[model samples]
Every structure is written in C-alpha cells, then in structure tokens.
Target: MTLLEKLNQDMVQAMKNKDKDTLSVIRMVKASIQNESIKLGKEHLTEDEELTILSRELKQRKESLQEFTSAGREDLSEKVRFEINVLEQYMPEQLSLEELHEIVEQTIQEANATSMKDFGKVMGKVIPLTKGKADGSQVKKIVEQKLK
Candidate 1:
C-alpha cells in the first residue's frame, strides 16, 4: 500500500481505539499534505513528498517540545512529547551513527564534494539517502566536520 493508504488505515484504527492524541496528529499530517498538494496543483503527493512532510512535522514537534521543556511548561511539553511519539511511529528507524557516517562519506565521495561550497550538493544527496532514518541537523554537522 502507498503511504496515503497506510495513513488512512492508521487513522481509522486511531478513531476506533479512541486515540485522541494520535488522531489529532495524524489529521494534522494529512491536512498539511493536502494543503501542499493543493499548492502544487497536484491531487496527491508521492511517497517521498509524504516522507518530507512527516519529517518536517516531526522536526517541528521536537523543537516545540524542547522549547516547552526549557520554559518549564512540563504539561505542554508532555503533550507535545506524546504527539511526537505518535508521529514517530510512522517514521523509519533511525540509523546508527556509524551507518550515517558511512553514508555521508560515500555520498561525499560519489558527489565529489570538494569544499564547503559543495555542502548543498552533498546534503542533497545525503538527505534522500537518510530520509526519515536520521536527524538532518545531526547528519549535516557530521558531514560538515568530515568535509572541512
């Protein structure tokens, strides 16, 4: 099944189970994807585009949770964390540091990333390879250290 199909099934399951938090997050994801598709004049998004939306949503949730915790709003933080956990259930398993490093190194070599100027090229290659499986910021930091 496609990502959309999987999401629809999960949404139904969440509704049947009365999982309010999960249902909320899943609805938010579906809406965001639908909005983006409308913007692009498309009826639906590809799996890759769906992953991009989900990844961006997860990143935003992590940042918001961090901020909430830092501000001592434990209740808000906890709710955000719960939502994040629900959202993350759909993400691919994250790669080990070793695995990410290996991919970055190989892609850098393959793309002939020669200097800091080649960061974009390398990142473009790396993100797709590591999509939903690693933190983009962490991967960028590792790749930058290796390249420089």
Candidate 2:
C-alpha cells in the first residue's frame, strides 16, 4: 500500500484505540504530506518525495530530542522520543552500523576518497545510496573515522 493509504488506516486505528499521541503524530504527518503536494502543485507525491518529507520530519524530531536532552527537559525529551518512534514506523528499515560502514567504505573507494579532503566526494556519493536507510550524521562519523 502507499504511504498515504497506510497513514489513513493507522489514523483510524489510533482513533479507535484512543491513542492521542499516535493520532496527533499521524495527523501532523498527513498535513505535512498534503502541504508538500500542494506546494509542488501535484496531486500525488513520488515515492522519493514522500521519503524526503518523512526524513525531514524525522530529522526535526531528532534535533528537538537532542536539544531537549541537553537542556535538561526530560519531559519534553520523552515526548519527542515517542514522536520519533511513531515517525520511524513509516521509514524504511534502518541500516545497521556495520552495514552503513560497509556502504561508506565502498563509496569512499569508488570516489577514490582519501583523507578528509575527499569528504564531499564520498558523502555526495554515499548520501543518495543510503538516504532513508541511514542517519546522515552517523554515516559522516563513520566516513571520518574510516578516512582518518
């Protein structure tokens, strides 16, 4: 099923179960998707477009979670953590660290990237390959380590 269809189904389930958190998250995601479609003047988003929106949403929540934790706002951080979990359900399965490392290594070799100077070349090639499956920051860390 399409992401929109899945979201609609889950929204209904959340309502039936009286799951306020899940319901709110789903509504927000739906709104974001709809807004993106409207902005782009398209009735339906491509899979890549949808994935981009979901990834943006996930990134925002994770940044908020990090800020909250650093600021000692445990209550807010917990809520953001839950939101992250909800959003993750819609994302493609994440790559394990080992898998991510392997992909980065391969990309580095393909790009002939040596040392930090070829950081951009390696990252440019790697990001598209791992986009929704791996966290960009984590991939960067691994690349930096491997290059060093």
Candidate 3:
C-alpha cells in the first residue's frame, strides 16, 4: 500500500485499539505530509516526497529525545523515544555499515572523485543513491574518510 494509505489504515487501527501515542504520532506525520504538499503546490506527494517528510519528522523526534534526556526529563524522553520507534516503523530499513561502505566506494569510483575537493560531487551522487535508506551524515563521514 502507499504510505498515505498505510498511515490511514494504521490511524484507524490505533483509534480502535485506543492507542493514543501511536495515534498522535500518525496524526503528526499525516499533518507534515499535508503541509509539505501544500508548500510544494502539489495535490499529492510522490512516494519519495513522503519519505523525505517522514525522515525530517524522525530527525526532529531524535533531537527532542536527546534534549529531553539531557535535561533529566525522563518522562518526556520516554515519550519521545516511543514516538521515534513508531515513526521508524514506516522508514526504510537502515543500511548497515558494510552496505553503506560498499555504496560509498562505488559512488567514489563512479563519480571519479579523487580527493576531498570532490566531496560535493561525490555527495551529490551518493545522497540520492542512499536517500531514505541511509543517513546523510553517516554517508558523508564515510565518504570523507575514504577520500582522505
């Protein structure tokens, strides 16, 4: 099923199951997708666009979880963590270090990136390759290490 359809189905399930936390997170994600569509002047978002919105929301939750934990707010942190877990359920499976490294190696060769100066070129090619499957910062670090 499409992401939006899956979200709608899960939202209904959450409501029936009285799963308030899951329901809240789903609502937030749906709202973000709607906002993104409106922002881009599109009636419907492509799957890639939906994934981008979901990634952004997941990043925000991770940051909030860190902030809450650092501030000694265990109650808030736990909730944020739960939200993170819920959101992650919809994300593509993350690439492992080995898989990411292989992609980095291939991208460097494909782009003929020979030095740090070519970092942008390599990244431009790599980002789309990894997209929702891998974290950009992690891929960047790997690319930098490899190039140097």
lDDT of 2: 0.94
Identify the leading candidate in terms of TM-score: 3
TM-score of 2: 0.93
Candidate 1 residue lDDT tens string, 1-148:
7767778899999999999888888899889888889998998888888889999999999999999999999999999999898888888788999999999999999998888999999999999899889998999998899889
lDDT of each: 0.90, 0.94, 0.94
Rank list by TM-score:
3, 2, 1
Error of 3 at 95 (Å): 1.2
**Per-prediction backbone clash count:** 0, 0, 0
Candidate 1: pairs in clash: none
Q: Scored by Cα lDDT, where does model 1 land?
A: 0.90
**TM-score, candidate number 1:** 0.91
